[model samples]
Target chain A: MPSLKTLIPAIAASVLLAGTATAGDLVSYKVVDYGIPSSLTGKAGDAAAGEKTFVNRKLGNCLACHQVTKLSAHPFHGEIGPSLDGVAERYEEPQLRLQVVNAKEINPDTIMPAFYRTEGLHRVLKNFKGKPVLTAEQVEDVVAYLKTLK
Target chain B: MKTNWNRITLIAAACAVCVGVFATSANATDWGPYQVDDRRSGYTYMTDESRAMQVDSFQNPGMIWVEQGADLWNETNGKAGKSCASCHGDATESMKGVAARYPVYDEKAKKLQNVETRINTCLEKNMQAEPYKWESKEMLSMTTFINNQSLGMPVDVKIDGAAAEWYEKGKAFYYERRGQLDMACKHCHEDNAGGIIRANTLSQGQANGFPTYRLKWQKVGSLHRRFRGCNKQVRSAPFGNGSDEYLALELYVKWRGRGLPVETPAVRN
Candidate 1:
């Protein structure tokens, strides 16, 4: 087994990120800039929880458009974006977080919705007007889960 | 020797065809890019269980709504003391092919009108009757009955002339990504038709079998109801029935499914 030194930080980070965005976390409404490194302040992320959010239809909804081999057990992985089978082999954690934050920044015409940023959208549904798809810590959780593919 | 060579070539060709079929089935929606829009009906993607339900009028629950619609057709209730039959005579004659040509331009209103709205138009203008609410059982029954009059007739809505602009708008809407999930109708219906989405096989989103009896809903539903459900799934606010945006969309979608045989009271999962 790997030393607790490495596993402890990741474990503690996941715990911290587990409750990062409680219902009271209204700071998600603030102006969030894309392409920022670790824009989520000091929150930690849980890969297991991130995996749940990644597959949840109401949360990330990422499976609706992207195919991920890690999630093959879950049917209907979409075909819109590149396969996320070996995503960690392609990009670093920070880069993955940036993509999750705002993929349109990399390619303006990309159909992937920004999971963290809040502004510049069209006709946001009334119930979800001010909410982002994934909270900041949730984005980190997804990034952590993705990083494990390698 | 020549005959043997010919047989070898024939076998190679058969193998190629088999491979092509396998690719489509195995990959489902994994095609490289969206180049053309496929307009096939959702019926092609249905499960055998649902198909059995759709084909049997005895098993199809939509027939219940169709029966209710027939009853409403002859009943006179408006202040004008006129039923639908009174104004139009036999539906098989007056309403024949009428449903096929709808979502047409209304020059007086300068808007696209659908079957439900057209019913409302006559109710308020000719009969002075109260209009049915969107997705109400009464409207579903009436729309299904009128659509059944066009059953087996090919869908043939106009996408040109005054409707041309709305058609373009709807085309844009189909291709344009919207909602928090940022999905376009074409992403699933056009580009990924025949692919499985969770438990449901994705169809081309054709309107041919609409006012369809959805086994999921356990009730008959209008095309707009299906549209609204899709919008909500993508985390978008659904447009109200007969609204301008949706009416234009209906025109575009109907045109997409042009020539598809009508399957009103059709069943789907």
Candidate 2:
């Protein structure tokens, strides 16, 4: 059995880790030439789950400003942003990853929200202050889903 | 996977009851920072049933509070022993065209003031009465009653003079990115008006129908209240009601509908 001193530190370390997770601390990555060339979770995402997030209003809500021709059964795709049809054919996976993570990096004037960024935002509500709108895994999932457009 | 898609489609259909997918007027008119020529009131975006309620005075829920305001206008309750009616006389004659041009830059206050702020100013300075709370039933009733007098009149507010600086600030506020969403007012209301966001149809977000009876709230609410709600929805800490930010925004938004007729106590979903 471990000593109390050792046990206490172990418990404290886990508590600290849990707090960080709950606060939605971002998984850091490097952007090389406007693209993140790594998997956020170091594993491939499920394209099927990504499709659900694309449509869920309370989730990614990409359909709010994007149109996916394959998802036409879902009504009222917005026209403000360009349509997402054949997007994968135009860009590779790394570029898609960066776009989902933070489109503002590519286009400063773009109205698209940074789904995986938390810093430098204004007047964020108390509960949402440190949290990115989508989790890093969700961002990967969205990128994975975007790849299926081809 | 197929079942999940089916469920989402079902939910989308349910939302359609409140959100009509019809396109807005095709005429594109150029306005400051916007090219939407199809200026339709928020009323144009509401469901048919909600619009019907606004047309029938008997069935309109907001008329209930307006009737109460008629009584409050006459009952004297202040150190001055005066009522809004005592000085303004019959609101029908004294208040017409007043609400239509409000959120006006008050030279005395040195700031813009909406009908709610104006009402509170009167109660404190003129009547020597405790001002009504910003969202109180009495305040909503009074503003609704006052604005009803100006119903169908064009919204005509001045942005020239000292008001011009504040108008610029309000315009900046409308375009600046805000909250966790990083969206400006223009993202939805300007760029995507008449488009669906989930199940809700985005309107031009005009200020014509204010102190409106919203089915979502199940009661009449002031424009400031709606502003706070929109801020919160974008995951931003909302400014307080009657704050300078909202007062300036009111001026800017009311100016956006400069030619649309006022639809006070308007019904909305």
Candidate 3:
């Protein structure tokens, strides 16, 4: 057995190595299939309605962190997150949907809430009551609009 | 009418100043959150005996956590034939001034470490004990005991040198949008501070006084638990309890409130 002094360094090193390895491949994973479903498909989500979801303080409230096109009339935009101008080009419709519905399904260590998963996480809202905040159809609509971001 | 308008404008300006002064006055109370008195001066103020009692501490649920911590401090654990006391020798003296400087950049680990992470390191190696799961009661209690030693001291997280990189990383974590709500820490704490969200008033959300007792949580919680709570408030997914991102954010927030007193068991509205 390693001495206590030596063991700590070893454990710390392994943890650091694991973190770095995961960080390098951050972008390659698929987000939607794990649990999140596409919000855009079939009847197609209305971009206008989706836009409302992006800014509605009580509902989607996306503007609280991200900066989108201000010309569209959404106010009180924040710079904490990222600019959403060209997101559509970076991800497919299904991927976009998955991120919206549940980013953690892709990254367990994420800070994104699962808008779609209704049950069985340790510290989620009881209002979700074992149901996702948004329906599969609603997710499709949001995904459709998000895909147009580029 | 022009004269009346000028008078109204003057009155409005005076009102703004008065409100500002009043807000600053509340910050001056030394007994309040973060050990900041009415002037926002960061000076910790609690008698040693008062510090020992959970009820006499800040009105938050963290008092309960501190109580639990006190118990754990004396309890024996692992193969070491020791409690934390066996090695530290009276934490009130040995551990003083320790809490204020943490989330230090470890050259060996090449990562930031807060008090809890460091304690787990001790348990795993020094004590030959199994590490407590992150956010476990055992971990929280031990951390609270250690930090209580530093009560009334100003937080002193050094942000220069290699620690600077960790600070920046923590800042990015605070600002990044990830979960469904896509909200950052600045949204609720900075931009919307003093505003009403649902029923809760958005505080400036400083982390100077943590291991705090929040009425909303009805329990003593770590800063990372609060981070998780904030993520949930925005409808975003939360990071795991002890993830590096959360630790980095904790480091940054501690640094941001650097001069503030350690309000380990502070009460929050």
Candidate 4:
């Protein structure tokens, strides 16, 4: 474990990154084992807004793979990933947070995109370079919404 | 009466056990999700209206481009004052089954060449004309016309000999992840081929119906154009229309759709 001296700069950098982009950036996070133990935005996300983000075609698009029976009102919930019917019951917030941030960390072969990571990506277009697919807050929002699946 | 009831119960229990065994085996197979059991063409995924549009030549918007190409074939241009008709003559006889065998290993160029490149090669060498820009009206029309000749012919691109190296490269490219989405072609086209992504149903990304008239574009477009669009969707820097990368990838994709009838100028949404 490093001292607060080493940690302070890293936290400051994340704050600076978050400040640069109003709602989008690759904010730093600490991954412990198979999960990120805290909120990426350092605050609880809005569950309502998270649900909207979850179903939004251009945003989370979690429905593109994982089916959520609660959101059956929306057309075409894909079967590529396991259904998130009782996802909240299966995993804690931390585990879900890590899964959203970068599922490749948990399962390397997973087709799921890393929603909050930008490093080591290949041939990213000019407009999306150095940008995570989902913002830190969006990641939290998705995690919050996912927690409501129970 | 009691014996008959017991027999009925035994038969019902056996049926239940059989169903249980079959269900577990089916679940264990793991066809990657959505379980696409057979190869399907992009046409199968399109709406009925789109399907109808492809079948009727008079109604098919691509037929317009095919007609345009026919006119271009006979029109003389460039210093040689030669039209495609001068050398090739009747295209119906000569160009038949030509597109199906293309993206072939060009011995002279020492690389793979698709129908588009082959067209340009003839324009430069035989006609002494400037090569039409890829995605240009002339190129799209010409390819649509040429590919139409092989409408029902199965794609049979050679992957052996010198073409073998390119094939391996293409296969690697299909599986290798790229872009901000970090998706390989296989992630959607293979693993989730029949699955829905938003409103759109993902096809196997077959090349059987290329130089196709897509409803989204509202016009005829080349295979390379579609490739660029997919790469862009994944937030990856798109390669050039006729780049070596796309050529190799195309060859690989064509191989995947081998035995599927060519549906050039086919309508798609």
Candidate 5:
């Protein structure tokens, strides 16, 4: 498996090849460089509460394909995805927020569903029309918990 | 000598009884959940009345696309000024049993072709019109309209000959790991089937009743889209729409649900 460091150059090359107009692109690299407010800055959140949110189906549901320790009661924890052992050390809080909110923004071809950007992306359930799967507050909480991984 | 003969006869009778018991247990085991018994027919939750209701409610946003397909069938396009109806006639009659045999090996192309690809080919070659983009609303509608005509037929994706290669490719892809997260399809669908993934019970991830009306989606969608969704959930970089990997996986899924009746628009949670 290629490390994220190795994959970044290839991803950058592909982005260049796709001819994306960075000026209008929200959360684009240009915007990141231009010092737009990153999605990560917020009040500190409880990791214990966030841990509950991670395993809760109504919330994060992170254990579906990921194996996370300290949450063993949740059945059907999948091993298809990697174990989240040292994720905080790999990515900063803002990058983590971007990934959780919408991974495709970073990689246009990502399979990871946009937890925050529900509009125009998700096939809306009739009852939950216009509602995101995760709210901004919940994302912040999860991000807070993730930052403590190290 | 007579006592010895009597004892041998008793032992033979006991052996026969044991064989009968074993056969009965085996038959019972075959009917249990997760056993893909050839003798038993596939089961579904939708009833005849419910299915009729769903069909009648074609006014739904999802079915609106199908209605567009109904119009497209008769409308003329391309320089030839010929409509799809010109050759296929009434789709209800012409397209019956067509969906069941799809994703078949195309001898000319020397590859597997699904219903959508074949339809595009017909549009380009026969009608002389531009082909619809794969996974476009127009294409989905057209394909759904055609597939709806073949409801109740058994799925018959051929797995022999050159088509076998595609099936194997699909199987390998399903088991292979990828993405930053590094997971495979079987880790959930097979290994943890019926187990709880948070609140929802993990289905075997069968694709027999596709273009299903999912509670989460609140609309009917194709199996390919579902495959894409699963990959996304696992944090893998997704294959592009209509990519060969997705197509191969679709073929494998269809084969997995072989012998199950085509549920063109099933409701699922």
Candidate 6:
């Protein structure tokens, strides 16, 4: 077993991390730097699960505003945003993740919604306050799926 | 003539200074001709098949509401035993060009009032009847009846002096973002006028076809009724029909369709 001196620091570190989550104030999200994070919550996301989220209208619904020609069955994909068929070849993984997390950080007027940010939004219902449109895990999953588009 | 143009420019520039113009207001005030009189029937982005139905008077579904309106126009309903026809003789003559100048500034009321208000005023004062509820079928029938007389006439609402303040308010309202969707009216109607969102193709959202027939509702509806529907789509709470906000919006959008012909009982998706 670990000694008391070592256990004290370990317990404090876990408590600090736990407090960051628990749906804290959305203002805290400003700490999410403009560029990429070193890792996506330190989890290895399943690509298969991420692909399902990409196509589901209730989830990511990216297909609503973009055309991904790779999905043969999805018809009449929107032409508003550019096609994302070979996006992985055009952008690095970190850049793609930034755009997915919050495109408005780059272009303030882009109609593309911020899928994983939790600040400066209107009418986020009571139960959903401080909650990003998708959870942190979902964001990681989507990023993994997007990296496969090449 | 040069002096008249200069005077108008002075008024417009003054308006800009007073109101602090919004960015989306420019798009609301400046748009080229929307394709009308063709298959699209003013809503240029809707399907050609829907447009075909609007042009064919016999097959036009809105004609049913027009026919219903015609019946209500001549019927007696108030406590005074008076009908719209009792004082205003033949509608074909008395109501000509009336709908074209609607949402006028009422001097006594000190506010902007549209055709719906005018109809209700007559309903209560002239006929001594209870005022019709907003968006009610009876109100729609009367409004459609009166406006149908001005069919094919170009929209020519006069927006000068007192009307100018309301017009600016309407423009501001058009560009203001609301609801969880955070969408301004100009985004869908003005910016993406020809773009497809989901199954429907967006149009310039002109009000010339109001008291329009929408297949979605399978009924004739007022412009304010459509306003409520649009607000709900954006997840915003809509105010009461004929509310000041909606009336101001009506005036502004009417100016947007300035030269377009009125197509009351206009068929829409």
Pick by DockQ: which candidate is best? 4
4 versus 5: better TM-score goes to: 4
How high is the TM-score of chain A in each model?
0.74, 0.82, 0.64, 0.83, 0.68, 0.74
**How many backbone clashes does every candidate have?**
0, 1, 24, 0, 2, 0
CA deviation > 4 Å runs, candidate 5: A1-150, B1-65
Ranking by lDDT: 4, 2, 1, 6, 5, 3
How does chain A of candidate 2 score by TM-score against the true chain A? 0.82
- TM-score: which candidate is best? 4
Error of 2 at B209 (Å): 1.2
Q: After TM-score superposition, what is the CA distance of residue B195 in candidate 2 from its true location, in Å?
A: 1.5
**Candidate 5, A130: how far from true, in Å?**
33
- Order of candidate numbers by TM-score, starting with the best: 4, 2, 1, 6, 5, 3
| Candidate 5, B228-251: lDDT as tens digits | 788776555577666778778888
Q: What's the lDDT for residue B22 in model 4?
A: 95
Task: Give the root-mean-square deviation of each candidate in angstroms.
Answer: 9.0, 12.5, 15.9, 6.1, 13.2, 10.3
Best by lDDT: 4
Candidate 2: lDDT over CA atoms?
A: 0.84
> For candidate 2, lDDT tens digit of each residue in B197-268?
656788998988899898899999999899899888888888899999998888999899887888888998
Whichever of 4 and 6 has more TM-score, that candidate is 4
Tell me the tens digit of each residue's lDDT in model 6 across A1-150.
Answer: 999999999976765664123234321122134445433566666678888888887677777767887875876566667888899898776667667777767776666766676555554445445566666677778888888898
Q: Is candidate 3 or candidate 6 better by DockQ?
A: 6
* Per-residue lDDT over A54-114 for candidate 4, one digit per residue giving the tens place of the 0 to 100 score: 9887888888888888999998888878999999999999999989888888888778999
In model 6, the runs with Cα more than 4 Å from the true position are: A1-35, A38-46, A117-132, B1-42
Taking chain B only, the TM-score of every model is 0.86, 0.86, 0.77, 0.88, 0.77, 0.83
lDDT of 1 by residue, B108-169 (tens): 87888888998998888888899988789889999998888888787888888899999999
lDDT of each: 0.78, 0.84, 0.66, 0.86, 0.67, 0.75
Candidate 6 residue lDDT tens string, B1-85:
3579888999999988767655455345221334333212345555668768876889888888777878988999889998889
Model 1 regions lying over 4 Å from their true place: A1-39, A42-44, A63-83, A106-111, B1-37
Model 4 chain B: weakest 10-residue lDDT segment is B29-38
| Better-scoring candidate (TM-score), 1 or 2 | 2
